[model samples]
Target: MYDNEYFVVDLGNCTTTGEIINNLSLALETLNHTGKSIVLKLNDNYLNQSQLLSIQSLITSYGCSLDTIETTNPETIAIVENMNIFVQKPIEKRVADKYDTQEEINSFQPFSMPKAEEKKDIIALKDVNNLHFEADLDALKRQQESIDISSDLKEAGINPKEDFHTIDYQVSSQYTRPQEVLNEADNFSKSDTAVFVQQNMSKAATMELEKEFENAEKNSIGVYKKAYDENNFQEDSWEEVDFYETATTSPVISDSKSTTYVNQTLRSGQILESEGNVVIIGDCHPGSEIRAIGDITVWGVLSGIAHAGMSGNTNAKIRALKMNAVQLRIGSCYSRRPDGTNIPYILRSSIFTPEEARVVDGEIMLFKINQN
Candidate 1:
């Protein structure tokens, strides 16, 4: 018998960090209905420092406080204490030298701080290799040229780690192995995470290059080639593929069409996003949400947030079989479910009938669909 205000989250045998994050997302969504804080009642589950910190950050962003934490285990108690210390004031403060008393300093005189040590440069040695060259002087000249290039790039704020550090050797001639060039593409830095190959490569080479880019956290891979014999390269010749989603996908579209249909009810924390119009055949729970580019048509009770014209379609509208939405948005206009006292008589009577929300005079207003 908990209070009516607070949203209670029961952590039942869910010890993993992933489970905690998923559950907390749902709990946060549900808390939107009551505008109350969240309470996690731990049942044989413990959260580590990282998990607690993530939870604290999530709730803070939601504009809702983590009200209470109930746990019985001693391990859980220690974790909670760490969370309190993390959230409390005075995270880090510098004290003045004179803040401490002379007597106190004298008592701890033997534990005086050590002097700041001077930093020493470290030199690494590499294995020597003998290679056939035109002349020893030529090798030395190439080494000097590489050094000059590296220094120039560093002065220009272009980190050479992506180029020089990753490359086994520079391709000085056309006879240089393509495999070596492919290998050098693996080296990625914070600034430059991509490699450009001007030479024409085969499909196999392109596939290998894309694989390397995927490992280097690069999304866009550009392969430039001449489109015609005249050397006029159009934008079509510059082939580019977005590798971000193929390696690791973001939120995906469940259905794609002018009118997308959802057969099942949306649970807490479940988000339904559509490129075109959306039609939900089931109820939208309190924590659920639906965002459509065109219109939103709900055949069941709609208690969640519904956004129509998400892609800037100003003529879009939201229609629900039972008009009990927490909030409705049509284009730039939005309206929340009015309180009992504020709800109009016509709107109240059509709660069971079909009700639509549309933008009227730059504001979202509710209207009932006529049966005649």
Candidate 2:
């Protein structure tokens, strides 16, 4: 049995290129050579996920049974897909030209800017086959004459009102009720049915006739001349329907290496360093800081500070004896209190304990990491 003495191994300020140590398993083997189970005392606070996984893997590889792998604040990185949709109003249906000076019209007068393929609006209608003209035959001729009018008025180069002879026909078609046809089978269901004397005819033949009658009575979208909600009408032919879930998938962390803290403040101008877990023993002076890519714990007073989880580890935490730090964070998130107002308590006080920083409304909360 060993005496009541603790052997401290200060992991010298080492430069870790990426998330995982180059030879993590070998590093763990060296730690286990002491014949002591791995008790990672993170001198530098600020533990990121990649380093956490690396350290855990190292200890396990060395078969150094975790005597007490104390990790505070199980950092949680979350990417909630918020669906705030921008709804666009459907296009409106413009008024169609259908009214005639005398004759009835059916459809809209679709305008086109004389495509090379199609014939121009210039009509040979006047010289066409013999036909009976409408009652207002003079007006009909005048309307046709309007399309062939001089290019000046057509291009808005000159207003027709300035011309004496121009009648200025502002004629437009008015919508009319469609001609309704009465069906002979309107009351076919209530009408008398004659019994068939033919023996060769099967019951199946008789049933088919009845089924057709039932279908005609049932209402449908096609049965109506217009859509149910014409004001908000959208042509089904132009619209499409398909699954959009694939386009709205969650993000995947491609490389864990990119998940380490980049911007960091080292203790003094000496450049603070870390391997995995970093612990702060005293209150850090303003402008004087410490940064690491692992867990951060302050056993003493913590003052001027820019605490953060520069890496993308949402599970990383900031725990202190007093947590009124100026800045706090885990991963890309930044948790901070106002200047002068945040008085971080870092003493071995009754209220302060070694715990992981938890989240209370997205902001970091300093509390016992495992009181739960």
Candidate 3:
């Protein structure tokens, strides 16, 4: 407030005690003032007695004038008045002369009051901008996310930087010993291939599995065979043997005709020639031929040629579960449907039945199943 005789310091909005100390210190060092009065213009900030004592000491040591302190707030004015510092009024003298005596000023002790000491961690603005002391939470999270697990492993000594040969300690010695590997190789080297396979591949289990598969296949075939026997009762008389065996066997006696049983199906282009009766447990498909000196009985469908009683016994009969023959011969006599050609569409309905064919009055004739 004094014109040009005093140096003025306006600590504009210096909110913190640290900021007030810094501004006041800057003013004391920078300003050109000898014994001239110096004024501190605090807008509304209040300084505690401890801070005021420090400021008073700095002013006294610096030999600067700190007689009149200006503040707008009544609370600040009360604090400055207690400090024994000069307070200027408009067109009037200082208020310290009227309010406080020299003895009271000499006895002023800011330390005598019971006040809590506030500690301020003060850092220069330049130092704050230059140093990275605190970590940003979001930046730290991003950095952690970018860190590689391999690098962490490296830090944990899981994957050492040294070469394998250079490493003296045995980290993997527990997992595998050299003596154990040599013993394993020595034990297996003398064994044959079969022994090696049996020991290493667990071939016993594999063989057991194969036997189980074979048994399952046999059981499935037995089930199908049981079903075939139940439906075609005449197949019980037939033996499950190769068809070629029937053709290659020795010729039977002229008086006694030997019965030959074939269990498998006769496909097209196959021929079964027997010296006596021919019993087929399975189907005789189209284009197959069966020639027997005696009766010919088929347990399944007979869709091919059948020649029975080739030695001229017209009484020999041919029976089947389904008989769709292309031609039926009994004692050298041939019989067929009304149509000359064996068209499956017509023959299926006429001949395909559980019927029998025989020589009736010297003519090959199809007849209904005769139980007698």
Candidate 2: regions farther than 4 A off:
1-271, 306-308, 338-340, 344-355
lDDT of 2 by residue, 1-372 (tens): 222121222232333524224443545545443443433323223455455555556655655432322222222111000111111111122321233321221121211122323322223333331122222334545775687656757597765545423222211223221222112223223212111101112222233445455556321111000112222223642345334853686764332122222222233333233334455444455545444445666654344453334334456666665454545555444554432343322221323324456544444554444332
Each prediction's TM-score versus the true structure: 0.29, 0.25, 0.29
Select the stronger candidate by lDDT from 1 and 3.
3
Number of clashing pairs per prediction, in order: 0, 27, 0
Q: What is the lDDT of candidate 3?
A: 0.56
Off by over 4 Å in 3: 1-256, 340-352
Tens digit of per-residue lDDT, candidate 1, span 1-372 = 222244445565577778877887886675463444556656656677677778877877877667556554435545665455211111112432432663432232111111123111111111121111123435655775676677789898888775344212211212333465465555523232112221212223455444454567432221111112212223533454456644785654433235666766787677776656777766787767887667789876788888787644457878887667777776645555533313332233232446777665555655555211
Q: CA shift at 108, candidate 2, in angstroms?
A: 67
How do the residues 10-56 of candidate 3 rate in per-residue lDDT, one tens digit apiece? 57479887998888888777764556566676767777778778887
User: How high is the CA lDDT of each candidate model?
Assistant: 0.53, 0.36, 0.56
Worst ten in a row by lDDT for model 3: 219-228
Error of 3 at 101 (Å): 99
The C-alpha stretches of model 1 lying farther than 4 A from their native spots are: 1-257, 341-351, 370-372
